[model samples]
Target chain A: MIRFLSILFILVSNTIFSILEIEILKGSDNLSKVAFVPFGNESGIEENYGSQISKNIEKNMLLFGEFENLAVNEMLSYPSSENDFYYRDWKVLGVDYSVIGKVNSVNALGNLNISYSLFNINRRIKILEGEIVGSEDNIEDISKIISNRIYEQITGLRGIFDTKLAYVINSDADTYQMCISDIDGKNEQILFTSKAPIMSPDWSPDRKKIAYVSFENGLAEIFIQDLQSGERDSIQALGMTNSAPVWSPDGKSLALVVSFSGNPDIFLYSIRNKRLVRLTNHYGIDTEPSWSPDSKKIIFTSDRSGSPQLYEISTKSKRKKRLTRDGNYNARGRYFPDGKSIFFVHGNNGNFQIAIKKLSSRYIETLTSTSLDESPTISPNGNIIIYATKDGSNGYLGGITLDGKARFSLPVKNGSVREPAWSPLLN
Target chain B: MNKVLTSLNTFFLILLFLSLIFSMFSFPKLNIDETQSIKVNFYELIQQNDILFDPPAANTLIKKEAKKTSAINEKTNADETSIISKFKINKLDIKNEITKIKLSKEREDILRVSAIIQQRISSIWIKPNSLSESLIAKVLINLAPSGEILNFSLIEPSSNTSFNESILTAMNKMTFFEEVLSLERKLFEKNFRNFNLVFKSSGEIE
Candidate 1:
């Protein structure tokens, strides 16, 4: 009986916990495998500067979702200089590229010098080498700079790690806060709070100020707040809803939506003259104005063609042209980095998701598979798009590459987050 | 009763021993001459690059060469006309020999090496995530004669990094191929020394 029972138990356990064979599909094809060796600390400082910088660079690379970094534990050797490097070691480990560095004390002014080198392991050649001198507080910034240089060298595109993101979180019916955070959603600083709704936060081209729609006085108003001074100025819509402010590329004027003429229309507000110029006089709802990259035209959502669709109007000629034809509900269209395509919220068959359309080819590509995906904002480099999505009862922010290859979600702990605006690449 | 049982057992043991001796001598031997002739025919077909052609054509070519050789052997003291014919046939045979020696061996070697490489690479290749079937990456591999990979470079990289990395990893996993060592040095140098492999998830070789 004991033998029979043991056999029965083994069979049940084997059936219940059968090994799962997951099919590994292909990963991104162009990603270079890079390993960051811990920099040597000849300075004798207590802080682990080498590990810290390496970790920071690794984090930035992971966030970019392009290059694959070798885990420190997988590294067989940590070579900080050319003499210590063994070509066969990294090659055997399948590392295509590697970065090595050393930190040393430069002077009595508490300045430290960092020398770093990047090598292509497969080709066994040195690609880049540089040195920087800075105090301890500047280490993080210096690391980010190094990351940007590496990213540019590998991808041939400028890195946007130093950029920021502005978004709004609705805590309750009566509480709302507009927050600004780093591109990776760190260092979140609450810029403003209001009992009424705060929506459609946009950054100026110069990154000095943010313009957003605020309902603090029980009426929709547009406010331009200086990020450094904590000062703000508002423009009253005069008993009409005014929202969806977008900055032109030149930072000279803002194109916004105002319903002052008894219907929603696009209006341009000039900072130099402090005057509003009405651009569209359509009877249907005209809102969500986004400027073209060249600043010569503005694309806005208009229901004049029966259902809401994207339409572009020239800032000079004031002539209008319809941009979207396929979807019955297309709105919130913003120009992609190249200005050839526009990313927007697309709605069909009770599902709202993000989509992109190329203007020249009239080619539309649906980006998100999830329902209720809104607030699609393209990254500065145009490689990624972040949007608001709902999973079950909770609303969170989700990001996806432009090719729909990689996806990630950033969920707020307790509140619903929405209206994500990816800031321009900051210095 | 014990005596009778021992006698019966001895009779059966004698029968088994006789059968074993008889079976050993009766085992058929493989015809060595037939196998040699078949090998010669195969080599002749390969030399003519006629392995892929109709069998009758190869047979005809063999018969023709045999008839010519016999004619030359039998007509050693023939007249002027027949001697001239023999000279022309000999010249043609020499040209055929040169062409066969130059082209057929190298072509066959190239085909064999390509087949071995494709099989080895496909066996170990693991596809990366988020790659479409349409995506392809061209990889150039430098290898020693023993099939030890010296270096790998992406000559035409795909837009997806994971796909390229997976191919490179697969190449690395197969540190060396034992099959490659059997190839001739000239063949290895002409074709297998440095080669480009186009990798796709479909596992189809073009």
Candidate 2:
């Protein structure tokens, strides 16, 4: 009896100790609105450093989905110093956050002082501030670095502005080639050429390799290409009609849809064990499999339930559950960065709009009203999705914040762009 | 000699059993009382302040108003004046109808608050009972800013932590705030700044 009581006390103490774990603070659902005034480079440098910094910060803030950067023209007042900050001016504009920075010379040392701070307009508090020392030539590089630091301090996710995006650009009507560009759609580097239609280019978890379904050999084949080496090889499989190769979170396997068994089904190929584990064995099409953050489950669109809807399957237990129930076309589902919800393309009345499904309650909210919004790729921060939409005569890659704000288009020169895959943050 | 030795062993065993029995009752009784005392302190503090628990209903209305249409919520807290001096005793019936409408609207607002808070709390790790003082101000301002969270880096992250799990947990847990929505107009839709949330320990749990 004494021993029993001792065990009971130990268990109760353990429970109490466990209950005292740290509790996380919940912020508002409303994303932060920040205005980045172009950095003033007073050193008479040829490059407009302020404009560049503003652009860089804008791209980073947009990618995180948590921030909305106020347009330069929209800001009512410009405050450079503490005296310039009028809280009422910001209050009238409904501006929640404001950022101001300057680039100044540091004597004969040729070092530059880049000082910036993030201010909370609503609370009238400066949330973040820092200064960096860099050479004049390194201002562009320094701006990128500071932008990342500021981004992480606010969004709690690494910024992907410094990361590159690989997309297919229509160089001409007959030429659809794969090109890699900065996240802002700059510094375009053509990686591969395929007038035969290159589709579905996905970044590996580590951002080292790109797995894309290329139609080079007159058939759809999943090719894993080394970004640094430019060496490419196809994943060896039984038959053709394999596409949409999504890398596992561990980067040890690829979850893809293969039609080798005469019907499209989800298949997992292990890079280590060299074994293929077939997950979905249905007659209906099971395509576009995205790995959950845990890498234990794969969510894909299947018509197994009479209409196209999103379904999730456990990689270990092989158990499957339906995620979307609303529409006849709910396909190309991707997991949010936190793995709490899934975002997919929902079609109704012949229009495809972006929709998100809360995994626990299966509540679906249609986000986009624009038709032909195909191939939604969420940023690493899970704040926004960059997808392809038809803009009049051509196609453009545009991004919309998860909260459904103003959509911005990535400038693709004279060509219709599609299948935009936002890369993970580059280390 | 054998009889004496057996008696000695029996005496030792009896003493050990008695000690164990006494400790089993005494130690837990002391510890449980201490924990209970801490909780009682929290309750007393809340009662003294007169701050409501912010029921789930208010949380939901706030969320819908923030998400669906910004116009519907711009004119909040407008009808709180008493109709005392304007010969309004004859118009009491009309006033009662208006009060009923206002009460329902207030209830709806409470429902909205409840919904938003429910989802927010589920994600974040807010300390029990200490939320009103420790987190309410910062969270309300940061979330109600009408924009996405930005510049959310950590200060003095532990050198031992490789993944920065605490920071990630804090960011994921926050979904919305009540104060950010109360501000007028939707001016800055883009940029956001991070708020450093610090927790303080109260004397006891309520």
Candidate 3:
């Protein structure tokens, strides 16, 4: 018994002392390379829909410059099925992932079936595969579905290709138009056109309507425009000025700014009963109120401390806490998707730029270098930020990935584009 | 009586365990004759010549015993103090030399290979963004002697799904480590055959 016990004890101790451990703290700064091969087709489609669908998916995946793609000419072979797909080909090209698909025949309902697969070359395994069915004419929608799946599988982030953006465009000195379009700046729709100025456009949580400040009525008023019906309604807020309307997470109320006798303070307006509740009653100027993701607190810009700084107020207790102190002008603060950090416009040495600050830390990080960058809007995934920047006296929308690795701008509109609001993702 | 026997047995068991651990890891022991030592008293040797020339003392037994001690002095022929003064050896210096020359050579091999493996993983791991919460995930890797990765498992996972997926994706991209081929076969089996990788997101906290 004694000898047996000693052996067991020695074995346990040896296992504990023999293992090795390594610590890794850094990650690659390079974007992953993806190869999108031209899909195959069964005997039913005529217009070469396979290539068109693959091309659209490729464009969507590379829209934000988060990934690198292998050119079609660089590919050695076009593999549409698993049998034809070979990992050796992609590995030689240094491609990390390969995407292939085949367009099946139309069904009885005239819906085309497309099957897609994504493979991790090094692991030699099919990471994702699925079939999507849609109308024959809606090929773009089907490609979006497939791209979303591939993106989700690879990056573990929600697919954001189908999301839209809302911004105000000024075509002329007098004409101000409210517009909503796809994130790629396609499928543009003019919701409201007025002779007065339009500002502070926001999307409701449900994404069925948009709430923005339109000055067409000779006073600053907030209007909710229905996307499908092109109908607009004003939420008769009790004030001389009601602007900066941001929807709460629950889609039940709006955290807006109201100026009562030149005192601009934040208020919450109920969309159903048109009731207004005072959230901030300070004599100082307070505006640009935005709700946290949890709807428990509202962060806004206030000059209560002798300068425009960011502050958050609890909804239930009405208790306020100062958020920013490093800069003299820190305003328009919005919580990140995760609610751990906040990004806002920070003015340093007379130059205004976009800056981010963690709630638990005191240091602030500047993201943009160009002065006059304002109205910064973050994607739902919190991976990208698009702000209004000016080039040669013309305002345009500029975007950058959160990692600071990629910077790109939206296609220049004929009019000056300002105040870009990213729409919420549809469930 | 029963309690005393059990206690005595446990004491012997503990002593045996301690001795076993020391023998396995400590330096080799040398066989030296510790019982016989040369004791050279400089004061007595200098006085012995003077006393021999002088008259005999009244206590003759004491004088004879002193003479006998002087005759048995083995170090009388050489100056032991001068020899030691010429070559002074620090007690701590020997211990330090043993660790520097004997232990560091083995440690240097593992350090060089571990750094290369760490850098390779860092070059392929595309960390996800906006992970504000500090997270740690551990992955266990098993490698063959040919420097090829045999298997890996996420033994520990963070609360964030995206963070965990990023680590797995990077690991899947690495197929061979080849740097391990330069390591000795014994060292490879002892340290690199199976190892744990601790990935930290807090290193890039903004």
Which candidate number maximizes DockQ? 3
What is the Cα-based lDDT of residue B98 in candidate 2?
Answer: 68
**Model 3 per-residue lDDT tens digits across residues B1-206:** 99999999999999999999975654422233345221222223335434432323423434445566665333332333322322232223345446666567779989999999999999999888766778899999999999999999999998878788788889988889899999889889989999999999882333
DockQ of each: 0.02, 0.02, 0.45
True contacts kept of each: 0.01, 0.00, 0.78
List model 1 lDDT by residue over A23-109, tens digit each: 222333345679989888885576678778778888887784666788888999999989999878888887878999988664677
Candidate 1, superposed: residue stretches over 4 Å from native:
A1-31, A236-239, A411-414, B1-206
TM-score of each: 0.68, 0.60, 0.83
Give the C-alpha miss distance for residue A187 in model 1, angstroms. 2.1
lDDT of 3: 0.86
lDDT of 1 at B12: 91
User: Per-residue error at A93 for model 1, in Å?
Assistant: 1.9
User: What does each candidate score in C-alpha RMSD?
Assistant: 21.7, 21.6, 9.9
Candidate 2 per-residue lDDT, tens place, B142-173, comes to: 33354444334444343222123333334443
Tell me how far the alpha carbon of residue B202 in candidate 2 is from the true structure, in angstroms, after superposition: 27
Tens digit of per-residue lDDT, candidate 2, span A310-352: 9889999999988888868899999887787788899998999
Task: Give residue B6's lDDT in candidate 3 (0 to 100).
Answer: 100
lDDT agreement of model 1 with the native: 0.76
Query: After superposing candidate 3, which stretches have Cα over 4 Å from the reference?
Result: A1-18, A107-110, B1-92, B101-109, B144-146, B180-190, B203-206
